[model samples]
Target: MNKNIVITGTSRGIGFELARLFADQGHQVIALSRNADPIRALDHPNLHPFATDLTNEQSLKEVTQQIKAQFEHIDILVHNAGALVNKPFEELTQADFQKVYQVNVFSVAQLTQLLLPAIPKGGHVVSISSMGGIQGSMKFPGLAAYSSSKGAIITLSELLAEEYKEQQIAFNVLALGAVQTEMLEEAFPGYQAPTTALQMAEYIYNFALTGQQYYNGKVLQVSSSTP
Candidate 1:
């Protein structure tokens, strides 16, 4: 069955690949991004690109309103947009933390709340986190803020799962390892990861499509030992 889907940060990287994945599979994709040109350039009939800054409450509200008015139900909601600031823990300022939280945590929670009504029973919500958020055996330096924000995403999903259990809305987080994306490059600076954004997108797409049938409120860590 063709399902209505909403994905954030679809202008590039994993989000862009996820949008393409769903559109190719014949699902209706409402792709959200700060810049919509790349999404529009895909030119997939099943893909609809909407540009909005998720950090702005009013802007997010307007986008949600448009979505609510246009679509009767949303089968999958992927909160893939995030912000990252890599700096020493002492070098991080309050403003930096706020900015990271605004995109990585606050916007996701707010958008999920607004779109809850549009998600019918058996709907799925998946948020992308990082393995930095996971309790990795090896700690990563200069990622305190980013890791903390990603960790919050997992907890939020867990609580939402319990809170909305009756509705059968499955909330899950993918605590991804290092994937080859611009975000990864920004954080690590030239270091390459074994996984690519397209590969991660494939895993995410499958999980979002059938995850509810198997799991809920789970934070699954995806990683590869290959350096």
Candidate 2:
């Protein structure tokens, strides 16, 4: 069955790949990104690109309204967008935290809330987190803001899963390790990762479609390396 799916951060990296993968599979995909050119270039009939600013509340509301008015039901919602700031803890400011959380945490919650009505029974909500977000996991120096924000979303998914369990709208979180994505390259130039964006997207694509049947409110650490 073709599904009405929504995904964020579709301009580049794993999110971009995920959008294309779903569309290629004959699913109706709404790809959200600040810049929609890349998605538009795909020219896939099943792909619908919408430029959206996740950090802005007004922007989110407008997007959700448009989404609800278009798609009668959203079968899958992938919160794949993230904001990262690579700065020492001492150098990070309150505003830095706010910026990261706004994109990584606040937007996820707001988007879900606004779109919840359009998600019917058997819908799945998958949040992309970081292995660093897992408590007691390997911590890095300049990722205090990024990791903590991911952690916040992880907990939020768990709670939402429990609250909406009766509706059969399963919510799950994936704490991923290092992936050689544009975001990673921008944050740590010249560094290489064992996993590529396409590789990770393939994993997420399968999980989003079928994992809900066996898991809800679960945070799976999908890591291939330490750190």
Candidate 3:
């Protein structure tokens, strides 16, 4: 069956891979990113690309308008656009933390709320979190801002799942670990990541296909060991 899916952060990395995988599987993919020109150049039949900055409310409003104009309903909504700032607590400024939260937490919730009307009763809402969100205060250090933002996402996902349980709209979080995306490289330069973008994409796709109510309201961890 074909699913109408809208995904953010589709310019590259995990979001790009996820969009390609879903489109290849005969699903309608509305790809959202800051750079729409590149996504438009793909010219895939199952793919529709729109450009918008997730952190900017005005840009997000324009993106939402486009989605409303194109599709009557969306079966899947993936919140994958996030920012990470990895610096020691002393080096991190309040502005830096606020910026990260704006991208990773605030915009995510705002976009989801705006698009909730378009999500059907049985649709899915997937928030891409991080292992750091679950583990909390990692020994790796220098990730306070990024980790906190992800932690907030996890909490938000749980609350959303509970709030929308009666409506039957599933809300779940994927706590990914060390995926080899541009974001990961930026967060931990010179470090070898554990997972690949394609692998993470496959995991997300399979999870979405299950369509099981049991997965709803849960934070499913996806790593090298998870299958």
- Stretches off by above 4 angstroms in model 1 are none
Checking candidate 1 for backbone clashes, the offending pairs are none
- Give lDDT: candidate 3, residue 224: 57
Best by the TM-score measure: 2
TM-score leaderboard ranking:
2, 1, 3
Candidates 2 and 3, the one with greater TM-score:
2
* lDDT against the true structure, each candidate: 0.92, 0.94, 0.86
* Tens digits of lDDT, candidate 3, 1-227: 89899999898888898999999989999999898776788799999998889889999988898898889999999888888888899999999999999988999999998999999889899999888888532435788898889889999988998999888999999988888888877887876777788888888887775643568878877755321
RMSD to the true structure for each prediction, in A, is: 1.2, 0.8, 2.1
Worst 10 residues of 3 by lDDT: 218-227
Number of the top-ranking candidate, with lDDT as the measure: 2
- The TM-score between candidate 2 and the true structure equals 0.98
What are the models' TM-scores?
0.97, 0.98, 0.94
If the candidates were sorted by their lDDT against the true structure, best first, what order would they fall in? 2, 1, 3
TM-score of 3: 0.94
